[model samples]
Target: MDFEIREDRTAQGRVKLSREREAYSRLMQQGYTNAQACRVVGIDSRTGRKWRNGRSADRRQKAAPPINAVVPPSGPSRYLTEDERLHIADRLREKATIRAIAAELGRSPSTISREVRR
Candidate 1:
């Protein structure tokens, strides 16, 4: 079988394979599927699956973690606090727009929308 060699380039026209691998690994850590992460990283889905399943180019068993794998955060979220939620509720009662509430809380409009939906 012939395998295609793909080179990912940066915005400054620099080829960086390690950076692409890191991006793929990060996407996977974020719960993206192999195909989706491969699309985002500009690589073949087969390559992503191989990395995830810990297989070498010859398809032999080689268990190993991806390079530069980042550990996921395990602490309390730094997002909106209880006070902010209360403020958002008050603003909503006052018929304030989502954008207006977000601006007051220094957050994005989608953040306010998601909070209200919750």
Candidate 2:
């Protein structure tokens, strides 16, 4: 089937190909495979690939954040709060194991043991 690109090639034979890209997008949305859409649009398969998976313009944009980035603390850390202190006190009264309270508070057993020792 001869599919003529209806977009005006007014840019001196270098067609804008926006129409072809649009057609490719539609064909893909309608469940056509990548190669099939490219063939139907009369564009190179590579062109369709570039359209579907766009090229990153800037390499720096993909770089990971700095290692020393100072992200603010989202929760209690470095010190146990008064609530944690109270819980530990109550658990100690009940003769609960250090590991048990640590598991409940999502802290290491050694941390709970050290806190009790302190």
Q: Provide C-alpha RMSD values for all models, in order.
A: 10.8, 12.6
Clashing residue pairs in candidate 2 (N, C-alpha, C atoms within 3 angstroms) = none
Q: Which candidate should be chosen as best, given lDDT against the real structure?
A: 1
RMSD of 2: 12.6
TM-score of every prediction relative to native: 0.39, 0.39
- Please, what are the lDDT tens digits per residue for candidate 1 over residues 1-118? 1223355343432244666677787788878988888887787787677666764444675455545465765643568899999999999999999999988877889888999999
Estimate, for each residue in 1-118, the C-alpha lDDT of model 2 and write its tens digit.
Answer: 3457555534423246656766777787778998999888877787677677765557554432211323478655988888998999999999999989998887888888888999
Span of 10 residues, lowest total lDDT, candidate 2: 62-71
**Prediction-by-prediction clash tally:** 0, 0
